[model samples]
Target: MASKLGVSIVAVLATSVGVMLALALGLISLSIAAGIFLVLLVAMLVFHGAAMDFTSGLSDSEAFQKAVEEKEQREAEHEEWEKEYWGEHHPDYQGEEHH
Candidate 1:
């Protein structure tokens, strides 16, 4: 896992790059680009929690383990949902052809 500080910095830099790319590509107006950057920065802050300093923490705690399990479950559920949705909506879906 990456340190929180490193992730935070990457998030900020990525957002900046995204905004600049969008503007340069004429995908968004300057105002909308700024809004996008602001939204992404706020999302990063929320997703990363309020910790400003990165410290080596124990990953063996029950809470940490449970959180990881929950995250994995959510990802699995999302993957299933995507498969189902695409299978229903896509014409070229292989599973549907087999059925």
Candidate 2:
């Protein structure tokens, strides 16, 4: 999902640059450039909607659930490791709040 958005953003930027270059070169008029930009915007929106629908469907699947659970478990393990590491490395640290 994030990658899709990133790609779309890149595409929009590239298109904008291309359109600007074309307009500067007198290859396309301002009205034509605006129309092209509008079309690209609409296409990006449609792609975003489709991507959302696809991701929503995946979220309800067993594989997606398992992957999420695995990710959470790994994060918990990493947190525990970090706490132990800090405690051992800093003897004066008591893992408490300081005022």
Candidate 3:
């Protein structure tokens, strides 16, 4: 969701620049530029809705849950490994453990 929104923001900025350049170069008139801008706006809204729908589907998916669990397990394993490695190497190591 956040990724889609960020991409949409970037797309909007790119579209704005394209429109401005086209108008400045006399390649497109003001009316045409307005239409193009409106189209981009509509496209962004549609993309956002689609992204939300796709994310909602994944939220309840078993595969997604399994992947999340695996990630957490791996992180825990890495933390354990880090503690052993750092604890042995630095006798006076009193740094905070990874959270």
Candidate 4:
């Protein structure tokens, strides 16, 4: 698929960069070392963001509010039904029970 192709492309590019740096600097220069480290760091950042959406909780607030409202509505309806159907016959009711 497209995703596989993209990954393969990135891999090839990164490998090419690493190999060229190794060849140019004999693997001991600060510039090449820093470049490799930066590339790795960026790749890690992209991976983390893609997997977990590390956006500081911005996306879930509205959905959380909607869920809370729906739960409250369901609880209110249940309470109303309980009052209509069982309030008189509930054992804790102080006055009487229907025979």
Candidate whose TM-score is highest: 2
Per-residue lDDT of 1-99 in model 1, one digit per residue for the tens?
367568878878887897899899998998998788788878777756645222234445766899899999998897777778878888566543334
After superposition, candidate 1 runs with Cα above 4 Å error = 44-49, 52-99
After TM-score superposition, the amount by which residue 16's alpha carbon in candidate 2 deviates from its true location, in angstroms, is 1.0
Q: Write the per-residue lDDT of candidate 2 for residues 28-53, one digit (tens) a residue.
A: 99999999999998998899888888
Q: Every model's Cα RMSD, please?
A: 15.8, 10.5, 10.2, 10.2
After the best TM-score superposition of candidate 2, give how far the Cα of residue 5 lies from its true spot, in angstroms. 2.3
lDDT of 3 by residue, 15-34 (tens): 89989999999999999999
Report residue 9 deviation for candidate 4 (angstroms).
Answer: 8.5
lDDT of 2 at 31: 100
The sequence of per-residue lDDT tens digits that candidate 4 reaches over residues 5-92 is: 4785688578767766785778657676677767776876676566455344435777789889999999889777766667656746
Clashing pairs in 1: none
All models: lDDT? 0.74, 0.85, 0.85, 0.68
RMSD of 3: 10.2
| Candidate 3, lDDT over the whole model | 0.85
Clashing pairs in 4: none
